[model samples]
Target chain A: MTHELATLEKQVADLRAKLEGIERRVPSNKLSMVVFSGDLDRALAAFIIATGAVAMGMDVVMFFTFWATPILRDPAKKVEDKDFMGKMFGTMLPKGACSVKLSKMNMGGLGTAMMKNLMKQKNVASLDQMIALAGELGVQIYVCELSMELMGFKREEMIQYPAMDFCGVAKFLEEAMDSRIQLFI
Target chain B: MSEAIHADKVMDLKGLPCPMPVVKVSKGIKEVAVGQILEAQTTDPGSLTDFPAWARTSGNEIVETIQENGIIRIFIRRKV
Candidate 1:
């Protein structure tokens, strides 16, 4: 073959490869959440947004950091290996999703109860139902290991969720970098 | 608003609030094949803006939206 033709062929192949790379590239359609609030209203908002994102056919990854990790704890499950601080933290923090207090107008738990009753009457999905829906919709949850260590939360104390794992903030950043939507709640 | 549309599926999401209506609509769109229409009927006031905005981002097409008698009906086509 001619040298000029060979050079032209190489250029064609390079262009084709670049085009293929662009064609097969993944879209920026993923959503990431940095959940830092432990309030019941905030938790409900996080899960609602999560479930809605999944419904929109977007991949959702929630990083449960800081106070948010306690929302996933199981009230009935207890570990015997906890130190004094761990035990104290476990006792003081909200045990589960259901036990979380409202960030506003808690009114000594009466406001929370009234809100729950109103939601039931309005046919709005509760926090528990939203969590189940989030799970069913394939929402991935990452518990911050650092937060868990500081808060004295054990992995075994978390509720039985399908796609939950303990990870660091780096994982949250990695997921967030590729996501189209990122929120802190 | 004056006539009825032919849709492959229909969802009556009447009392559901913000996220549920869109969530159900998103779920409902999956039940039908590509190019087919899915109609969602709701009473939620937010759905007026939600349906259009959701369809835009989700890559679905809203064929039409009808509002009458305190009911908002959104017809969407699954594009992807």
Candidate 2:
């Protein structure tokens, strides 16, 4: 009977600790976004939402993984000593934010060029501008280390961003768990 | 038919497309004080709803949105 009582007390204590953890995890005025696309239009949308969230006084965190990781690579800064597969991947992927194509109707880059022309005429911010603005706005840019390892992307080739970091998914998940809004772009 | 709004700051976002209007307004809202009014003039049709929605989510109050000659003039009071 005493053993059963002790077990019950331990279970109650565990439940109480869980409850306290949940209470401490109350969502803040933050937006956690997973940027899974490297397309020009989608990247624009991600950064657009990110910068907009920042303007609203909410903290924004963008986890760039998979196809999205290449968007952060700087065209001017090239990393040497890559493996054969890494070189092939780097050659195939878009160099930077400006080189990415549209998701649909790219038409051998004509559509993308036309769309960029339209945005320019309309005075809309381009993807590069949005990314730069995000940096200026203090939006956290987190690159997925796993994706980096798979694609052989180096940290030295990343764009000049103030609050950028190369981290694992757990770091992003922790922030996402406490964010008021979570988006997978 | 209505009186002019004496805004604390005015942003000319004319010819900017959808999403940019609100994003511009969001960035530009920093110029106004907590209670002052911010006026944004844009030609984009999306601003009709975007301004009010952005103001709602951003904890700001939308004063009025006036449309004249394809130009949308929105007034929002900064609260955040």
Candidate 3:
């Protein structure tokens, strides 16, 4: 009986140590971002933060919604079965991650091109490169399902890079609750 | 001005901007074995602070930082 009791106590102590380890790592080591802008500069900011946090050993989740959804769209992928409004949106908005414009002084997209050139000259990684790095570093990219439905975007329309996940605000909120850093961009 | 420490790997991040140097360093450190050193050369002024902060947060050690002719060389020791 004493042997069994000692074994049980040892197991309890081990479990407590494991729990302490988890508590130390969780909540403080996670970063969550709500990426709500499709503008080139804003997307760059989001990716910079994500990559920075990942470099700091934080688990990052970037939830793309609304206007930001286009950042994940594949430039060459076409969306079929769209209603008139959807077709109009598809025609009007810039085609995907590659074609996103700047939020200010875009100058008919020339400003964005200039900014890309500047970034290149300065040796800063482009948005596409940052996204690839995030993927390599295990940063999770999530698409808002509601935003996709409202914007008439199909699952197949998104680029396959980084392996995205689809979820709703509720799910994002759940993640944010446990994350130490949360940003709405 | 001091003698340079031997590094297991050298990563060139010259001309890269804020965050890329650190990002690349973070990735490069993974390629080095524990206790080995990685030497990263960059022109990003931000890395002066970014490298130390990253090293602190990532549990690595920055053994040396050398600045010469607008170039920064940081030697990092992988701790884990």
What's the TM-score of every candidate structure?
0.90, 0.86, 0.88
DockQ-based class of model 1: medium
Candidate 1: where are CA atoms >4 Å away? Answer: A9-27, B1-3
How would you encode candidate 1's per-residue C-alpha lDDT over B1-80 as one tens digit per residue?
56678989889999888699998888778899999999899999999888888998889999998899999988898898
Error of 3 at A44 (Å): 0.3
> Whose DockQ is higher: candidate 2's or candidate 3's?
3
Q: How accurate is candidate 3 locally (lDDT)?
A: 0.88
Error of 1 at B26 (Å): 1.4
TM-scores computed on chain B for all candidates: 0.92, 0.91, 0.94
**Alpha carbon lDDT of each predicted model:** 0.90, 0.89, 0.88
Best by lDDT: 1
Query: Deviation in angstroms for A38 in model 2?
Result: 1.7
Output per-candidate TM-scores for chain A, rounded to 2 decimals. 0.91, 0.88, 0.84
* Share of true Cα-Cα contacts across chains kept by each model: 0.67, 0.57, 0.80
Docking class of 3: medium
Report the C-alpha lDDT of model 3 over A136-181, residue by residue, as the tens digit: 8888989999988887888998887665899999989989988999
Question: Considering lDDT, which of the candidate structures 2 and 3 is the better prediction for this target?
Answer: 2
Best-first order by lDDT: 1, 2, 3
- Give the range where candidate 2 chain A is weakest over 10 consecutive residues by summed lDDT: A48-57
Best by TM-score: 1
